[model samples]
Target: MIALTSPLLWYTARASGIVSLLLLTAVMALGVMTATRVGGRPMPRFAVAEVHRRIALMTMIFLVLHILTTVLDTYVHIGLLAALIPFTSAYKTVWVAFGSVAFDLLLAVTIASLLKQRISHAAWRAIHWLSYVSFPIAIIHVLMIGTDTRFPWMLLLVAGCVGTLFLAIAWRLWAHPRPDGALTAVPRRKGRPGTTATASTQHAPRGRKIASSGQTRKPR
Candidate 1:
């Protein structure tokens, strides 16, 4: 009974870690979807953007907790520094680096956004675009680091992320469809000769008016 319970607990922890990662990836994707203008449509509502931002921050918080718990459980030998740095992990250096890269990208984007007012809008906007890169890196990181990657449920999670992102891209492309109305020369109206005739000549008086005084009034 003790042996069985120990394995079950370990499995639960492993499952929780993957779940946390998946949620974080989803939060990142939501942020991207909200930031980008879809199909020539205006930006998402301020409320929507704010909600996404808050959710993303929460996701990050949960991710940190997840990492901490996983490390504490002792099932894996991941160190504190290893969690922050890429390619230093004992598990899989290259695949693990993907998570680190994603973390750096996410950090850049979050910092720039938080200091948007301090930085030039153009520069901030440029940095914010890194969110796109962050999202994909996050997905890759989860797929590689997750212990339950082979499970049917894990496969579904991966599919959902990829599918949603692809759909977003497709929608953006199809909705904005190239500017067909642009670059076409407008047809000029043809002008007729003598088109600017004088208005006074066109409205010439037919006859002159004359006034007559029928009687003279005495002055008071």
Candidate 2:
């Protein structure tokens, strides 16, 4: 339990908010990179995915603490319901609504992710994209509601998070576009391996015709 008059509570809340933003940024960046299968020797695709998941869990923790501290602070009129319900806060109602919106979206994304194994992949994926909404709303909340936004360092931080995510999304779209006539996987027979040709292969060379005797018949 944090003391209402303690400056430590205020500082902790601010720090947690900043950390949550950074973690959210990392989660989003790595998510894009993972979806695009971006990786190198030092880090593989699986590693990127693993890091993204762990960071998401951590982001949730910090976010909880941030909300707790905000509710605990006597300096603000923000209440518990305000955190859970949008536009209920008496202080900075509009800007705080952004946080509320982002929080709800992130909560949905997290819950859907936890039940991913039980749910259809398409459903999980559809809800998981709410993180995209969560990120921008969080960024906007921080920018408009945060006391540090006037500082150059904070501005740079905001710019960096936005710029990096924007570039990553652009790169992902450019690298993995599904334009018409895009090259798709070479379809394999239903029961056949999709890899190298095998003895029971069905596909043959364009001009070749195999006879029942396993001999190439003349192209008459």
Candidate 3:
């Protein structure tokens, strides 16, 4: 005997979920770009890293809202434990467990990032790898949930997300970087000799202790 307006809760949950997915997409793309150290003319490498962090934070915010609204809605019975513990929910049990798994991985990534300074680099990176796996698991969770999959637009959205993620990963892997990301060695043509004389010299002018112009030359 619930009110008609309860649909609003479900709608809010759906919207937040989609928004979080988009934010996660941006975060993943930015993270890949950060690794490649590539950026647009206006956005530098550091800015890319900064935007990645900010978008990840925003993604977490929307994710929290999505989880809360879904649990709070009276239409479905999603307990607090279902959100934290996998395979414990009675509703869409398997799909919900996937979401829960993603949530758990995300929690680890967030905590590890916050404690980065305290934790060793290898440990932090090991925990962060969960995020890459979590992204695809979340997509599968949504697809299997049967929420918006019936709509053509929803299918297109999921396809776009998958395509974007694959392309981002490909670019990240294909782009090679110079050692230390620096082009220190000068390039030469195929027929170039052992060395070429440069116009510039490192030698300083011997002015201070030199003999005057009128001074006679001494035999060495």
Question: Which numbered prediction scores highest in lDDT against the true structure?
Answer: 2
All candidates: CA RMSD in angstroms?
17.6, 6.9, 11.1
Q: Candidate 2: list runs displaced more than 4 Å.
A: 1-3, 177-220
Give each model a TM-score.
0.65, 0.78, 0.78
lDDT of 1 by residue, 111-178 (tens): 89789889999999888778777777877877876777778888797888778777766755566633
The residue ranges of model 1 lying beyond 4 angstroms of the native Cα positions read 1-22, 25-29, 36-44, 177-220
lDDT of 2 by residue, 1-220 (tens): 4447568888988999999999999999999887776655667566778899999999999999999998898788788999879999999999999999998999999999999999999999999998998888999899999989999999999899999999889977876732221122333234323332323223334424344534332344
* Span of ten consecutive residues with least summed lDDT in model 3: 195-204
Q: Which of the two, 1 or 3, has more lDDT?
A: 3
**Candidate 2 clash total?**
0
lDDT of each: 0.61, 0.81, 0.78
> Which prediction has more favorable lDDT, 1 or 2?
2
Query: How are the candidates ranked when ordered by lDDT, highest leading?
Result: 2, 3, 1
